[model samples]
Target: MNKVPMTVAGEAALRAELEQLKKVDRPRISKAIAEAREHGDLKENAEYHAARDQQSFAEGRVMDIESKLAEAQVIDVTKIPPTGRVIFGTTVDLINVETEEAVRYRIVGEDEAEVKSNRISVTSPIARALIGKEEGDTVIVRAPGGDVEFEIDQVQHI
Candidate 1:
């Protein structure tokens, strides 16, 4: 499988979720299943069926997380020297060339991209245009609304 790029924080979050699922959710679901089984007929017991479904979903998630962890290429931006160049895991401050509006974005993995939080996936149009560019450089991004120009104000490795 191809390696998936992930920031240190992203990797940590996934690990934490995996830990919670394995140590807490897994055991809790097993107990629920056992209790449901004791309630009576397996054929008609809604609780038993629900517990089973939950268990299946949880187990599937656990496997998915494990596979992602195995293929994750964790990148700690803080460990790299800041060169004002946009890169994965780096937070970038940009100024809209036309509107003069300032916005900040953190380049992260596909799974970690949350536009609401200003974290953009590396493959995003904006990020793609920003990557390899240094601070003070102007980049043009082709958005669905048309082309937008931005000036790179700052790059942070935090």
Candidate 2:
């Protein structure tokens, strides 16, 4: 499998979730299943079915996280010397060319992309346009609305 690029923080978050699922959620679900089994009538017991469903979901998540971790190429941007170039795990500040509105974004893995937090996937159009560009460089992003231009104000390896 191809290695997936992930930031240090992103990797840490996945590890935490995996640990929780394995240590807490898995055991809790197992206990629930056992208790539901004692209630009798497995064919009609809603609690048993629900517990089984939860177990399936939790186990699937564990496998997914483990696979991702196995293929993850964790990058610690903070350890890299800042060169003003936008790269994976780097936080970038952008200024709209026309409106002069400033926005910040951190390029991260697909699993870690959250627009509300200004963390964008590396494959996103904006991040694709920004990657390899240096601060003070102008980039044109083809958004669904239209083509928008932005000026890179700053790039931080944080």
Candidate 3:
């Protein structure tokens, strides 16, 4: 499999989630299953089945996180030399050329992309158009709403 691009913060978040699932959720579910088994007649026991389902989901997530961590290429953008270009993990400020609306976005890996926080995936339309671009560069993004024009105002490697 190809190496998965992940930021240092993203890797830390995944590790934290894996720890919680293994250390807390795993034991809690095990205890619940045991208590449910004591009640007998598991064939009709809703609690037992519920606990089992939760266990399956949790275990699957743990495996997924482990696999991602194993294949992750954690990038520390701060350690990179500043070149004033829009690269992975760079926070970019842009303005809509037509509407003059200002917006900010950080280019991140697929796993860490959160639109609500303005973190866009590297493969996203705007990010793709902005990649390798520098301040004052114009970008045309083919968005779902239609083609939109933007101007790069600044790039910060935070």
Top-lDDT structure, candidate number: 2
Clashing pairs in model 3, backbone N/Cα/C closer than 3 A: none
Tens-digit lDDT string for candidate 2 (19-109): 9999999999999999999999999999999999999999999999999999999999988898889999999999999999999999999
RMSD of 2: 0.6
lDDT of 1 by residue, 76-112 (tens): 9999998989999999999999999999999999989
TM-score leaderboard ranking: 2, 3, 1
lDDT (0-100) at residue 75 of candidate 3?
Answer: 94
Off by over 4 Å in 1: none
As for candidate 1, its clashing pairs are: none
Deviation in Å, model 1, residue 59 alpha carbon: 0.6
Model 1 is weakest, by summed lDDT over 10 consecutive residues, at 75-84
Tell me how far the alpha carbon of residue 70 in candidate 2 is from the true structure, in angstroms, after superposition.
Answer: 0.7
Q: lDDT, candidate 2, residue 80?
A: 88
| Cα displacement (Å) at residue 91, model 3 | 0.1
lDDT of 3: 0.96
lDDT of 3 by residue, 1-158 (tens): 89978899999999999999999999999999999999999999999999999999999999999999999999999999989899999999999999999999999999999999999999899999999999999999999999999999999999
Each model's Cα RMSD: 0.9, 0.6, 0.7
**What are the Cα lDDT values of the candidates?**
0.95, 0.97, 0.96
Superposed model 3: Cα runs more than 4 Å off: none
Model 2: residues >4 Å from true position, as ranges?
none
